[model samples]
Target: MMKVMVMVKATAGSEAGVMPTNELMEAMGSFNEELVKAGIMESGDGLKPSNEGYRVRFSGSKRSVIQGPFVETNELVAGYWVWNVSSMEEALEWVKKCPNPMFEDSDIEIRPFYSMEDFADVDTSGEFRAQEDALRHTLSLQKASLNNYLFFSGRCEEALNYYVQHVGAKIDLLMRFSDSPEPIPEDMLAAGFEDKVMHCEFTLGGAKVFASDGCNDGTTLSGFSLALTVATAQDAQRVFAALSENGQVTMPLAETFWSPLYGQVTDQFGMAWMVMLPAT
Candidate 1:
C-alpha cells in the first residue's frame, strides 16, 4: 500500500472569495464520497485563504517568518488529500476524476509518502517500524457513535418503523414495555401501551440513535434537530422531499453557504430533520 499526498493549488478566485457555489461544492463532495467508499482517501481538507496562515523559514539557528496573502498563488496549496493507493498510477486516476476544486483553473500534485520500509537499510534494528505500527493503531477504526436520543409519547414504534423504511435505519435492539424484566411501573407506561417501545436502539449510516416510549403524553420535540449526512445531492433532494411530504418544511432544501443541499423539515411525527449532501 502506497500513501500519496495530493496537493491542490490555490486559485485566484478562491483567494478573493470565501465560498464556492453550491453546484461546485456538491460536485466536490460527490468526488470525496467516491474516494471514501473506495478506501483511497485517508483524509483531506481545504485551507483558509493565505491571509489566515503564515510561513516560517529557518537558516542555521535563526528563524524568520512571513505572513500570507503571499505574492505567488501558484505556490500556495488551497487544499490537500492524503490517499492510500496501490501505486502512483492509481492515485493519478483518482485525482483525474476530482471536480474543479476551486471552481476555476487549479492544479493537483501527487507525491508519494515514505514508509517504514524505506528506512529498513539504515535503521537495521526495526525499532522505528515497530513503534509506527503501534502508534498507527491509535488511529484505527473506532466504535459506533451514539448521536441522538428521542423519547416518544407511545408512538415510538410507529416512528421507529418509519425511519427503518424511509431513512435506511436498522433496529439494533428493542424492548417493549411488556418485555421489561423488571416490573415497569404502570405510570411509566400509558394505559393500553404495554406493547409500546420501552427502549430501542437503531443504526443509521453506521451511527447509532436511541429512542423510547415514555409517559404517552403527545410530547412535542423542540430546540434541537437531527442532521443526516448523505453521499449525493440527488439523495439529499430525495430525502428532503420525502421528509417534507405531509409534514412542515421550515427551510426548503436549497444551496447553502456550507452545504450543497441544506434544509430543515419536521417529519409527520414532528421530529425536526436537516438533510444535506456530505460536507467537503
Candidate 2:
C-alpha cells in the first residue's frame, strides 16, 4: 500500500475564524463518510487559524520563534487526510470525487509519504533507512514548484517596469531581440521591431514568471489570468490598488468567501491579474 497526504487549503472565511456552514459541513461529512467506507481514509482533521500557531526558525545551531500570522498561506496546511492508496493516480481519482471543500475556488494537494522500502535500492540493507530518514529530517524544507508565463507586445519593457515598481517583481534575466544568436526575421526587421524584448524572466514575491515580446503586436489576450498570492490583508489591498492604476478593475479588492483580500484587474498592458492574500 502507498500512503499519501491530501492537504486542503484554508480560505478567507476559515481564517477569520468563521465556521463552515451547516450545508458545507454536511457535504464534507458525507464525503468523509464515503472515504471511510472505502477504507481509504486513514485519518483527517481541520486546523485552527495560523494566528493560533507558532513557527520556529533555525539559524545554524540556534532556533528562534517567529510567532503566528505567518505568511505564505498557499504553503500553510489547513486540513489533511492520510490515505492508503495503491498509487498516486488512485489517490487523485479519490480526490476528484470529493465535494468542493470550500464555497469558492480552492485547491487540494497530494504528496506521497516516504517509506523504508524507498531506500532498498540504495544499499539493499533496509536497516539504515531509519537512521538516514532521521538525519535527513534536519535539513529538509518545502520549495517553490510552480510559475506563470506571459507573452506581450512591444511594450513588454514598460510592463516589466510597472510590475517591478508596483508589484515588487524582480527581473532576473532579460534578452533583447538583438541579443539573440539567430538574426531577427527579415519581416520583423523590416517592421522596425529589432529593438523589442526577446525574452525575460522575473519573480513576483519569489514566484517565477516568464515574459516575452511576441512580434511586437498589440496584445489581445483571454482565457488565462495571473494570480498573485500575498501575505497579509494590508499587503493584498495595497498591491491590488497599485496594480489598478490606469487599468480596469474586474473585481474590487475585498474580503471574499475564499481569501482575506481578493480582486481581479486588467492592467494597462491588457493582462488580467488576480491579486489576493492566500486563502486564509
Give the poorly placed runs of model 2, Cα more than 4 Å off: 121-124, 129-280
After superposition, candidate 1 runs with Cα above 4 Å error: 138-280
Model 2 per-residue lDDT tens digits across residues 5-120: 99998776666677788998998999999999887888999999899999999999999998787677767778999999988999999999988777677889999998877667
Cα lDDT tens digits for candidate 1, 67-147: 888879898888999998998999989989988787677899988999888899987998888787655533321221214
Alpha-carbon TM-score of each model against the true structure: 0.51, 0.45
Instruction: Count clashing pairs, candidate 1.
Output: 0
Candidate 2 RMSD to the correct structure: 22.8
Best by TM-score: 1
Cα lDDT listed for each candidate: 0.78, 0.76
Clashing pairs in model 2, backbone N/Cα/C closer than 3 A:
12-258
Clashing pairs in 1: none
